[model samples]
Target: MADVAESERRILVAVDEGEESMHALSWCLKNVVSQNSKDTLILLYAKPPRAVYTALDGTGRREDPSGYLFSSDILAAMEKYGAEVAVCVIEKAKKMCKDLQQDVKVEVRVENGDPRDVICQMAEQLGADVLVMGSHGYGLIKRAFLGSVSNHCAQNVKCPVLIVKKPKTNAFNK
Candidate 1:
């Protein structure tokens, strides 16, 4: 068991290229994480596996005639796009922290896998005190069909999970 005094408080926030996730990050920064050296904020992004596409040759053959089996360019482009999204999210999180005047340590991690699996695994591996994420606020049928990453992470992770749901209000409500 790790000593209480020596263990730093690790708060892991799962982020993506979505407004909901960004809202969760902002909420975590404002509420959960403290501005102290003993607290660390980890922003995690999971890139889903790319789909494999096949190109036909001039003779209508399924495989390429140039001896190249697959399109490396397509794969590279997908990876590049994922990297850019990850960088953008991380930078935004950093800026949010700066705006909040939080001096806590911030770390960014990007991995290729399912978001549900990646978030839970990272929370456990980092010994996080709490895992924060955004709720898409899907309805029963939609959530049943599409499934929920936050629900899966909440169920699977060892630490407590915080799901930030976006507030629904009309202009007149405020």
Candidate 2:
């Protein structure tokens, strides 16, 4: 939350461990730089699929990792960069704007569930005015293989959705 006063404008952003997320967050800061309204920025992470969760133990048994639940991996990753990454968004905002404490609120929400469903539900629950997300910059093949969560979020969420796709990298040159 910045010092901008868009009382009706709340942003919910989804991150998938990519720099694109940082870009989106930066965009939000730019938009709400002087905002003085009460606003929230939710940093949400959908739970990985059963297969991804199972790969840890290599047991082939598919178990739900529990959406919105904090796990060791999540905490460990947050611990990196001296826990600065976890606090980066709000900390940066606080540093930039002296009114954050008096006017705006920022929260980090880590949820576990189908990303598509979780994003929409969380936005609805929070009464979000806009949903922000990284595009993952997938090509036809990668989108086809993994399914596009941003695309799904755009289609399903009632509010306007901003899908921020990073410039294509060599990772998807099929």
- The clash tally of candidate 2 reads 12
Question: CA lDDT, every prediction?
Answer: 0.82, 0.66
Candidate 1 minimal-lDDT segment of 10 residues: 55-64
**TM-score between model 1 and native:** 0.82
lDDT tens digits, residue span 71-170, model 2: 7776566546433443564445444334433454566675656878889999999888889887778789999999988888888899999886666657
Instruction: Give the candidate number with the greatest lDDT.
Output: 1
Runs off by more than 4 Å, candidate 2: 1-6, 32-34, 49-104, 168-174
Tens digits of per-residue lDDT, candidate 1, 64-138, equal 465334567767888798778778878887888778845778888888888988898889888889999999999
Output candidate 1 Cα RMSD.
4.8
Measured by TM-score, the strongest candidate is 1
List runs of model 1 lying over 4 Å from the truth: 1-7, 54-70, 171-174
TM-score of each: 0.82, 0.62
